[model samples]
Target: MTDTDNVSRRRFLQATGGAASAVALAGCTGGDDSDTETTTTDSGGDSKERNLKITWRPLDTLDPVASTDSASGWVIQQVNDTLANYKNGAVEIESRLATDWSIEDNTKYTFTLAKDAKFHNGKKVTAQDVVYSFERLAASDSSRRASFILNDLGVKHETKTVTKDGEEVEEYKPNSLAVNAEDEHTVSIELSEPFHASLPMLAYTSFSVIPEGIIGDVGDYEGEMSQKKFAKQPVGAGPFKFDQWQQDTKAVVKRFDDYHGKVPEVAGVHWQLISDDTARYTYQMNKNADMFNIPTSKFDPNKVSVEKTDDMGRKHGTYGPVRNGDTVNFGRVGGISNHYVGFNCEKVDKKVRQAFAYALNQETVSNNIFKGRSKPAQHFTPPAIFPGGASGYDEHAKKYPYDSSKAQLQKAKELMKEAGYGKDKKLDITLTTYDANVYIEISKLLRDKLASAYMNISVEPVKFPTLVNRGRNGKLEVYTLGWLMDYPAPDNFLKLLYPPKTDTSKKGMASYVNWSGTEAAKKATEAWDKIQANTKPTEEAQKARNEAYLTMEEANWEDAVMIPLDHPYEDRMSYDWIDVPMFGGAGRSRQMLNTAKFTGKRN
Candidate 1:
């Protein structure tokens, strides 16, 4: 399989703006400029650098920690630069004010400052600046980007009693938190324990280092600084700097004169927020947007480069280019995401869930609706995250093929009959989904198929915000949602459905609320806890961890908590002027600053 076919899920979300927290309106095509045609060569820098009109949905916020939308991320992709970034196959630590580093231990690391790395304000980036940037992230009240950093410093949240002077004070203290500036050029971070996810955590845009002076200059930086301010006017040590933001319309970034790395090829970057897929596609067609994502329906092979590959050794059917003559590139969108149908464990019975699962026609959805955009899935855990995941799942496929009118349906009917969900006793179920044409179609299709088994399936279309709230509140009967992995690893996926029982857990996004509270699943979650708790587990530890992941998946799936569907692929269109390798994680490609060069094409 080509990189496009066996697309790593990590890169897929980055392409589609995996951080999207809500729906946004697509950009309205500005009045056509056909009246004023100026001819110029398409070569980079041959003409004056014009404002780049990249299209995406508007973001909710720009606060690194709080903003989860792709629009916000695309903007941040320009203004902010991370300490270590993923590029060309590995995590390359940029010399963004920091030239080098030394790891004292698993819990302790020290970075050497780059004398020339300066902020947009022309202030020299110091070890103290790095320390301040981290402190703000740790104490911020917005989102939880701080927790990732604190965890990197081996700081665990623990409730404890301490004696201050002569009195005893009981409180919760963040464990092993200490940052010391050894000198003007070096800083050290001491942690309580070793954590594995640290490097990847730093890859997050939220952890991008900011000017220390900016924080103190603006008192109460966390409370006062809004994403609007950040998006409209941002300051960072990246190759590019923020210029202006037009709030849901567009934003601009110019090259930073003092950028420490190899200077960027382009002079400036611009963004046009477009929520509607068709509008975004049209912008690309009209040559307004240099790059934009397209849906499976409008995917045109004739437009761009396409390839097919088999990354997963298993027999996942060929997912690209039916004919080389077709111009549109076809393949899968990667990242750890599962398009699974989840049942409200509290409301749905096991028999009912299994019956519904059996009756659901995933092949039809994959073939007709998805248009071969996705592969039919059988397991809850996807192949990309878990090691040997494809191998383990290949065994299950022999037992279950895509068959809608077979013993599986018969079994479902028998289960429904036993559970009193038949012609005389139909169970009322409301399947909730957000406003996506594909998802809406899936819900309607399932509703029609379930009618064969005489089950009442009500299709409820809710707003995106309400959809998220309903899943978090555990109030929906059935819900359709997708999980794009934040990072590569089984832990990220496992943590979702298996958050701690307390309200303070991180798995709020998990749709299988029933399995999370169940005794067997809880036990599986505890086993995962033990694995993460280890200071430095041996190879055996990881092997055991993969085994645990399967245990968790089986525990949840056997209980009919969630049903796997398909892994959907996205179609992206870009003018030849926009050049970036399309086979990496989300952050790697599409960032205007990362591409060697991008030029506007006028046809």
Candidate 2:
């Protein structure tokens, strides 16, 4: 439902560094003495002048059209305003840029722009801006999410043949997309078919409205700036404005006074790029960061005391009294994502893939590696978005359950032997993964477990970006990656395994397993086609769609396309004085500090 660059879809956990090394480096105590030098007040005598500080990993591009990862999306959410957005802590969509919208015939959508909405540039938002934004999103070569508009949403568009160099090639007709500025403040969009998830899909950052004629790439009118400049210093109608970005160091955004919504109480937000687990932990313990994540290496279950759990499965608690003697508020929610070991189906035989899947135990990984902080994932789709929701996940999970039992190990050995591999003729393959300590540890476990199954597994640790590039180029025989939800829908997760997305020629970022040429692929393709056909909101249609999801998942199980490891829990540690949004199924990337309030002094 959401469009992201292939790399964006692959989310990296915040925790880095080995557990032993991290604990040894920082101890179970506080930060350095020098880190305690805190500024209590600003020139205006407000203690909140230092603003809210958060630790994050390195970000990719900031351009909404080009950004695919959650790192960039988090900052983008601050500087951009989409037509609709997920309500905080919930998947329900709410109006943002548009005051309200109406749907007709389940295909056509009409939105009435907020009369008071104004861009950071002080220009009034209009229907033309919305039209231009959607058009650019579809036509711009830089847009990784163009498919979300053209294909996934089934937006009506026309193509025309134009001669380039010596041959003729087809491209979208200028302004031919089925979006129209009906008036100064009304915009209408027509879809090729009725899509049940259209509203939620529109909530993605890719549909964020920017001033029309700002860039020269999509339309003939170009006035403001180049695409590159806009990416670095974007102007939007959100509550925050782009301040500065220093590559791998940090990015800052200042509050916009003229924001249409309730403005942020703080002066700005400072996102510190701290990739080291110890450093992030120390920074938070020192009270330098108002809100941050507690690395698994530094997390102690005994220190956590849960007060209650919400209906949405969010746990509210307090964690603390560390060596620094600080007790911070804590929150935990099941993440809408799945981390897995993917096989290149074109290079690895199906039986070998199945053998590896059976050999690796998800429960062991969840317990030993994640320390019970995550749930074992049996299906590619996380339970929150699985067909029929979390209630039915266990039923479908029974279709293909892989455990580390002796019997399963025996089954794995048999599969490997049937694939013409044995102790003497072991099938050698390398699993490339992000150079994070957790992933490396998981890979090593997998290597050790598969050894008995006559599979010689080598673990290759690379930077996150490098891992993504290798997977995209089909240079990896096997790899470790994870998919975060772009939207809360079964189709969003299922579409990743859709057969056509496996076509390297089309530059598919998902389905690195490339099972497009196998019999399982044929069955999956049939189910995928059916899923597309049953997009209507009728009860029968929804039932048929759920059945298709199961069929496709069964096909994946039969082929062992990928091994679903575990669904991690998103945990947050923040000073009790700082009230942060408990973003549950809505996703952490959409966490907005604008609504956050400073309730009391940090003791």
Query: Best candidate, lDDT-wise?
Result: 2
Q: Candidate 2: TM-score?
A: 0.89
| Tens-digit lDDT track of model 1 for 1-603 | 345333232443354232121110000013232211122234544323444445665555555655444447666756766665554312222334455655544556666767778787787777776666666566545444554555433454444687766667554343223766789778776667765555455666776777774633232445334543653566777777777666656566676767777666655666666556676556656666555556555654344343443332111112223222222222234434568777776688777877767777767777777776565666655555444645555664444433432325677778888887678788788999766667888888778877777688899987555776666676888888765544455665566556443122222233445555666567667766765665342466667676677666666555656676775554344455555444332322323354546543544
TM of each candidate vs. truth = 0.77, 0.89
Q: Can you write out model 2's per-residue Cα lDDT over 115-221, one digit (the tens) per residue?
A: 99999999999999998999888888778788788877889999899876676766667688999999998998999988767877888888889999988888787
State each model's C-alpha RMSD to the native: 8.6, 8.2
Estimate the overall C-alpha local distance difference test score of candidate 2: 0.76
